[model samples]
Target: MTSGDTTSGEGLLESLEHMGAAERAEHDAEVSAAVAPGREIAVGQGETLLAVDALTVRFGGLTALDDVTFDVRRGEILGLIGPNGAGKTTCFNIMTGVYRPTSGDIRLEGRSLARMKRYRIIQAGVARTFQNIRLFGAMTALENVVVGTDARHRTSIPGALLRLPRHRREEREAVEKAMALLEFVGIAHRAADPATALPYGDQRRLEIARALATEPKLLCLDEPAAGFSAAEKDALSELILKIRDDGYTVALVEHDMRVVLGVTDRIVVLDFGRKIADGLPDEVRRDPAVVAAYLGGTVEDAEDQEP
Candidate 1:
């Protein structure tokens, strides 16, 4: 039941790669359903999956967030964008339970997450990747992803220690699902590699795959396209779209306008920890305050630059 086993990687991949076309299709469908279970709402529906209601955070005399309110719709990619020190990551930390809000509430499907433990929030079907890569340096990519699957596993520590049948079954299933997620993120070929040995872009992809391994209903990505080249950003855009297409709600906190505009259905602009705009991508891109706060320019100047 532990991640110490390395034989699960290539063996499972070889088995998957050897499947017939029809079998592979079935397996892929199963992976899709497992990764995002019970998420079948239309992308444009006004249903709210997560609500950040008048959320404010402060440290001493400084207010990092000020009554910022927004919602991530049921099946859309909502981009949260802002310049540095504008409280983008601060919001993420609050949503993920790394920090409790000084005031206001964060609700997932109308349930208050204020008092929930970090693990409980994760079990409630919200998972996130860090702004900085946080993969286990010594673990294989598959092993790292398998750790995420632990959140959904029902086996007890006693069962795991006793080598119980249910524990072994869960381990086998976790390995299969982890490999499928790696494949989904286009990194199955590197499943056996140590996470530290991967390239920067691949490491980002690995972190995403690990997050997906949690079977989350809403996936929050913080600066996923950071430090990527143009081509890598383009590829990341496609991957994010593919993820959304497979029926998961996404909250993307990104800096790259092109990546955010290309993949998100809507955008929320934050400035000085206050929400300045919340609308379609085009509208947010054209907002005077967004232009000034983010790009330090006018709307015309922002339009002249490539999105």
Candidate 2:
């Protein structure tokens, strides 16, 4: 091998050595599972992880979502962008079982999600963070995250009431995993603080960590960069990319064109509750309908324009 190749290999090894043990282990497991015999990996390359099919929602005389359809591919960041009242959050609400669609359906990996409860949806490997901060005000950040981990625990309420050995064991594991998630989101130092006490940006990160604790197949984030400054938005963008690299499918809904264009693998645009464009960032930016209705001009104009 060339000397330069050896030096590059050494650099990669050093970086891997510094990688978080939990992250490394999780990624290795995903890789191994993908190649294992007779095992259909939960996350597969270029496969559809979520399918929103002809979803229509109506409240009284108004239609919130009119036959909206899209799919989030596994191991990719899909940006869902639109103007205000364009049914973005409504879509999120339906995906997470917060609202039942007036017509149409949502499926995860070919399983129809109709009639599923909110908790059932979470258990089905779909987790989300709200546009507004929804952290538990009285709970410490670690405790809040632990609650998410509990969603995946198998111990029954009866076992927990009796303080059974299995419950005790799972509780310990939950705390450890929660701490690792806090570290992953760059807020391990604030693990002991109340969630409400965190700075606005830190609070947002904490919400993301909690959602990650559920070990979701698809992570839906609604306007996570809504109130962030430019630097905070950049950090958040990196975190989103890290989440995707770690084998989580992300569907991001944001108003900021810069954030959407920078991190998304594909863009899905909605205008007046209808899909106007769905393609790569460049294609969506140049589409005349998207440019006029949402971008407000060319891509250059959209960079400084907020939808």
Candidate 3:
């Protein structure tokens, strides 16, 4: 054979070897993903459902969060609390993918959520309520909750427009589910009322109900007990525990010490954008650092370490 023919044969063999190596790499990746912890843990057996590692957020040199790190354990009520301007809401926003972190990482189960958008985050089994009451003012209470259930909907615009069999079935199911959620939150009687017409305490409950309609594994509530009476707070404490018992991992951000202590299995205290203490309710209550952070006293600062 001529020199050119020999060169062509050798080049074809090299190309085949490269293709085989690439195919093997792809096969290995598929096998790894099949055996990965994320695939198994997606069904919810891990100890930690949500984990934040060295989280920090900065708004033009104003550091809103400084290396905050914590985890929400599965099937427990975890309280995220601190004084005003302590970065609790910022942490909540980050956890819900409302704000991207300036550094560090967030993981759901073993899968990284660092690059997910707000809507994608919801699809990853997270839902949250705002600190300020937010509901569709013009919609009925049941309709507002139905909006939340829409997060789980897969119907296309064409299907919805055509009112196809699948779309009609899903619509009926969504309405039934929304009504069930309203009743669960003790507002079924007000289902036909405008969302804005509910009393302040009931409005808070409605927001929680709407969040629950999303069927999240992790529910983050921002100041849920705000503007509640003593009695309302008591009722809300029970509601939070009930949510936990219903197989949701609750991450609560609230100012009321009584509700926090009563409902939560553990508490993570934030001070000046840093976590000062984290432990069981009684342990955190007696922790000098937490006491100093809230009530203003001197306590030796413990080393800020990751959980």
Could you give candidate 1's per-residue lDDT for residues 275-299 as a string of tens digits? Answer: 9999998888888989989967899
Model 2 misses residue 124 by how many Å?
Answer: 0.2
Write one digit per residue (lDDT tens) for candidate 2, span 1-307: 1111122322323444566888668655543432121123334757888999999999999999999999998878999988899999999999999999999999999987767999999999899999889988877787777788767889777777776899766655566566677888899888778788899999999999989888788889999998899999999999998787767788999988889988999999998899989998877887888888887867576555442
Q: Could you give the candidate ranking by lDDT, starting with the highest? A: 1, 2, 3
RMSD of each: 2.7, 10.5, 17.7
List TM-score per model, in order. Answer: 0.91, 0.85, 0.81
Top candidate, metric lDDT: 1
Number of clashes in model 1? 1
Candidate 1 at residue 47, lDDT? 93
TM-score-based ranking? 1, 2, 3
The deviation in Å at residue 271 for candidate 2 is 0.7
Candidate 2 minimal-lDDT segment of 10 residues: 1-10
1 against 3, candidate with superior TM-score: 1
Backbone clashes for every candidate come to 1, 0, 0
